[model samples]
Target chain A: MVNPRLMVWLKGLAAAAVLTVALGGTPSFAQSGEETAHATDAVEHEAGVHDEKGLPQLNTKTFASQIFWLAITFGTLYVLVAKVGLPRVGAVLDAREAKISGDLDKATQLKAETDAIVAAYEKAVAEARAGAHKLLNETAVTADAAAAKRIADVVAGLAVKQKEAEARIEGQKQTALANVRAVAAEAAAAAVAKLAGVEPDQAGVDGAVDAALKERA
Target chain B: MATDPLHQFRIEQIVPLHLAGHDVSFTNSSVYMVVAAVLITALLTVGTASRALVPGRLQSVAELLYEFVSGMVRDNAGAEARPYFPLVFSVFAFVLFGNMIGMIPGTFTFTSHIIVTFALAATVFVFVTVLALIRHGMHFFSFFFPSGAPIVLAPILIPIEIISYLMRPVSLSIRLFANMMAGHTMLKVFAGFTITMIGALGAVGWLAGAVPVAINVALVGFEIMVAFLQAYVFTILTCLYIRDAIELH
Candidate 1:
């Protein structure tokens, strides 16, 4: 804080410097300086009366050359940066931006393609399921029809066998009835001969057998 | 002269050339200006000579500087100042380098000089004024008189505006000059104290000098920051003034 006050005196020194400069004194802009914190200890250490100069920048004499070089140097740097440097940096940034956007576009495109392929695969699976269902239904119907035909063939064959078996039983029954009648006639004739001395005639026996068979039927 | 904190600011003729009754001789201030220019050119041109997409440390520094000034111009001056990008960048670089180079133990700080800072400030002042004149015509004078104000207020406000406008260069030049000059002189005084203490106090006195040396070291770092800040102030102000001239508000 005490040190900062050193510049307080500089306000005057600066004014004096500016005044001297304005009044056409020596090129002594150097008089602009801060007082030491120990101004009391400064002890009048004066280099010369001319030594305590104002701001050197206010000097008229050096202005020409300094400005001259300043223009040339600063101007050249300006041109270089304007023409070359900024453009290069801009290009790098632009290229990076373009690359990023392009990559994003490509990613979107790939995602779209993947979605399309997935859709196609889903459609194929659906069609395959429908085709399998139709096949299952058609096979069931064909199996039913074949089973019905087989059952009909077995019934027809069994009916024919049943008719043949009934006819054979009827024939055997007729033969057995004829044989019993003939044997009965023979026995009756023998009994008559033994007990009453009479053998019956062929026509009589036949008549008797016919009458008996009719009664039984 | 070493004891003289102000001696470093002394201007002495090196080549002593005179032409057309004008003393245009190259001096210490002139040499530093050239040194600033060369270093800036090297920092920019050689630093970015490869122009790598991925920057090295030096190139990053160069690119950072470029973008820093670019951002300042864009922010304060608006996009119309895009064309003036190089000029602003150059001024920022020059002032920055000149100020920083001056911080070296035994070198000259040209920016501390009012002559150099004033010329720069004056040039900016002239350029902006001309720009306002060209773009706004006589309407530029209306800048002194605030718009939407009572006509009675014009008498009060116009002169104030014009005076402030004219004082722009003075303040611009002085702020940088005073800050640099004071800081440098303060450092020199402290350094002189440290040296004097070490010499006068003998073997044990060397330890007593540590305080000043430590403070001087801290001041060096602070001055470096001030160097950068002052350059930024100078450049940004230029941008704002240019923006004002262009927009005429």
Candidate 2:
């Protein structure tokens, strides 16, 4: 929006300038012979009057000059304030605002980047967790299979050893029984020969023993 | 009444010197102006020197003054106008102090005079105008002849705009000057009545004097309000002026 105030000031300055130019620039320009005469008469008429403060009455001689200077003073002041002072202030304000906005933008961009990074990191972590779970499952299955196979191999080996042990025991027992029977027979025959005179009837005895043994068997 | 108060308000030659082919007389008013300037500087310096986190009364007052002006500028001129804070703040402080100081029994109120107020107002005006011209170039003139005005009414509207625009300094100066002068004058008149009445019949004069004294006290309070109000008005106008110069619509 146009500053109504600034416009007003500019308009004042413009008017003052226009007036000055139109009135012929400065008091000297306006002070023609006729105007001076009229001024002198006006001043003489008002001379001896005094106010409550004992001050002399007004004079019209320097009226134009007063107006001129008033304009000049106002114009000069206006220029100084408008041209020099205000702009400096404005620049400071603009700079501060720009700085704040720039900071905000930087903050926003950083936040966005951080969020993206966090999301990607989270995704990677999830993938890693999933892979780890899959590996653990595969390891568990492989371990179970190896354990079962080992157990079966051990059971088969024990069965084979039991069979061999039983066969050995049976063979040894047969051998031992044969030996014992031979020894007993040898001893009994010897005793009979020595103690008794039964050796002459060997053929008859053998045939009888054979017939008895066959009947007992 | 004098066509202008300048003639009536002359500072007689307390000390006279001629310089640069002009008669220069250092008068009481001139001395006071110098004094006022120095006072402002000293007050600001002393008030702000400590720059305390928790302020003393003097510093608090100074800081309040600063905030008040800056706040006005921000509100009226927009956030973008923050850079102008110091200028606005200083102007407010100077004018405020000048007005208040003038109220003291023996102090001169520079703001009470038209020259000082006009000078201040004119400066604001010129500043804004130049800003507009620089920012908008020839288009700045369009401010006087607003766009979309019906062609038939342009003549009347243009003159009115011009007159209103020209009155900126006059209105600005008059507002401050008139308020200060009128208020002070009323106080003086009342004070005179109070004194004069006191010399009359004992009880009745005493009672009459009491009325004017009470009124004077009330006027004093009112004048204080006017002092701050004028400062606010001036600063806001400055912001508005800046906005016009910058935005032009």
Candidate 3:
């Protein structure tokens, strides 16, 4: 660890460096001194312009004041908000929520009621249709029965008229037949009387006519 | 003066007051905080005043905010988390309003402050811890070493779990604070650069400054997105924390 020659050489080098610095450092030092003066002057001027030194935030003296005011203001705010602001907003929101759900419930109820009404209307219409059908059937049956009775009465009257006409025709035919017999009997008696010159017995001729008519019957 | 990017975060006292030897002065941050509260309260109250069956614009926004947080609680923390809805809602509205209101120019961002974010995170941490203790009793300690994990690994895992659990507030606070502060700072820096460039180099600077302006224009949209995203992340994380406290998983 102890190198004597190297130590001597290091000591000489240090002496030479010191000599060099001593000789060379004077002008630089003088120059740096002027620069330092200028720097100080600038710093002084800058300091003069600024009212406060350093960061205002770092100023510990103002901490109490800031903290104090913060507490007061923050405290006041908390009170106002907790007591007034939040409740009001909460109330409004709750009210709006209640209103919405209530409206929805009402809407649902109305729809149900409407559905019931529509159902009732449909049922009434169905009953009316059934009643109308029944009425129509009853009217048709009554009209059909009346028409049938009228037709039957007309046919019965026509049958009676036909019977009476047939009886009259039969009576007329019998009368004509009686008249023909009478006329034939008269003519025969006259012919006999004219041919025989003497008056044939009228009673006898009448008796003969009667016997011949009886034979023909 | 306005060129300083950090200038925006500076708290200016609107009403100087001292109480218990502590400077309790009402500042610009407080004003915006109050304004956010008023706006949130007004939106919820006035918007729901009509109780219209069909909501209008304001009512829609109010209802959306309500449902969004409620759904978040239900989905993330489960039905058991229902009781905490108001607290969760308040936190969400406060943060969302803080972020969105900050996006407006010349407005102070309260969420950008570490103190405010830390307070919120600490409150959540305490709440969850207390809830766990109340609900689960001494069994809450079981959370440090996950069940089914090898008990032999308890030396390694328990510390890790504990550290991570304790780090919840730190991570939560830092994340929100850092994001808001960083995004706003970057916006301011770019805006200041644009002004400085235009002031220093005239026509050439105008052309050069347009680059930063364009970037800043894009950044404004990006910052707005970040604002909403960070708010969501914050609230969702809170919901998750509530879930953890309730379930101890």
Candidate 4:
């Protein structure tokens, strides 16, 4: 990220360097070079000869004071940091860490609880579906048994009715046959008497009718 | 006023006092050191005043600085340096704050001075030396000679090791002081060009002056980065030194 800025700065410095060289060369290019040289010499002289003591950093006079103040300030800063500042910052950081961990723990516990609830809910739904399936199967079986029993009862009633009707028809048919036999006997006796102009015996006529009926059976 | 690049490094006595025959007068350097200390203290103290679980902006910055130095100590110095965390933290905060504060125009850069950086480095060197001596007793001297090397190579390697060991504070101090002084001096020189150009050339000087200004602008950005880098270098070196003392490596 800073590379581009550095590049721009380098570019600017290069441009500036070129410009400085061009401008610096101007003094020699013009006739006023001697005057500028004198001014430059004057500036250098004053700068070098100002105190003649060299750099102030080399000055031994201020060393004691600087050291004295440094000891005091640095010592005080160390004490303040070690005793007051660091401990408090450390405490805040520790507290924040503890709070974050606590929140995370709580979240984990809640998630576990949610997972358990989901598991229980799923189990209940499964059990209910199984129960419904069992109940549906049981009802279907019971309904089937009831319908089978009803159909069996209806078939038995119809069979009994058919047997009774057949018995009644057989009885009527026997009664009608008896009546015909009796009428046939009476008519034969009457017809024999009328044709011979003499009385015919009932027993012989009955005997003849019986013999015919036996042959037909 | 003379546009001397070195002019900015000059220390002026803010309050003059003679202490027991010593010229221990409070100066601008002292003032800035005190400011740096106070600022570090305030950033740590006031920023964490709320002790909020969720930090505010100032608290976040304070925490970031705290963790940055803490991680530096932990990574470089190891767990044995845990007890000395405050010392490492203080040095880091002091140097970092001093360098950053110096980036402001016309501000006194205390870290740019040899005496100040030398004093800081010397403190670290002394502390590490004492710690090693106390922990290892006479065995601390074994640091000068590798155990696997032949006795014939001891003469060659021992002196070299000793010189390098002794140069620790010097190198440490000079690296920070030189970096800061050089960067600030370079910026000042470039800034001086603007004034010099205007002085040498009349109305047309403004257009030409833009060149040095542009250079100074870019240099200022670079110097800010250097300031951060130097502080990190100084603190990490201190941590490394501490690690060496503790581990005897």
DockQ (Cα-based) for each candidate = 0.22, 0.04, 0.27, 0.31
Model 2 — TM-score against the truth? 0.57
Fnat (0 to 1) per candidate = 0.36, 0.01, 0.64, 0.69
DockQ winner, 2 or 4: 4
Per-residue lDDT of A86-136 in model 1, one digit per residue for the tens? 566555556657878999999999999999999999999999999999999
Cα RMSD to the true fold for all candidates: 7.9, 9.7, 12.2, 9.6
Clashing pairs in model 3? none
- Model 1 scores a TM of 0.75
lDDT per residue as tens, model 4, B1-249: 668887888777778776786767788888999999999999988999989888999999989988998999999999999999999999999999999999999789999988899999999999999999998999999998867778997787787677668877877787788789889989999988989989899788888999999999999999999999999999998999899899998
Q: What is the C-alpha lDDT of each candidate?
A: 0.77, 0.63, 0.84, 0.84
TM-score of predicted chain A against the true chain A, for each candidate: 0.60, 0.56, 0.59, 0.57
CAPRI-wise, candidate 3 is: acceptable
Q: Which digits, one per residue and each the tens of the lDDT, describe model 3 over residues A130-188? A: 99999999999999999999999999999999999999999998898678667766777
Poorest lDDT segment (10 consecutive residues) of candidate 4 chain B: B16-25
CA deviation > 4 Å runs, candidate 4 = A1-52, A180-217, B52-54
Candidate 2 residue lDDT tens string, B82-178: 7666556656665777777777865656576655677778877987788789889999888887788678877876777777776877878767876
lDDT agreement of model 4 with the native: 0.84
Candidate 2 residue B76 C-alpha distance from true site, Å: 5.4
In candidate 3 the C-alpha lDDT for residue B164 amounts to 68
lDDT of 2: 0.63
Rank list by lDDT: 4, 3, 1, 2
Give the residue spans of candidate 1 off by over 4 A.
Answer: A1-59, A108-217
TM, every model? 0.75, 0.57, 0.82, 0.80
Question: Can you write out model 4's per-residue Cα lDDT over A95-190, one digit (the tens) per residue?
Answer: 999999999999999999999999999999999999999999999999999999999999999999999999999999899888878998888888
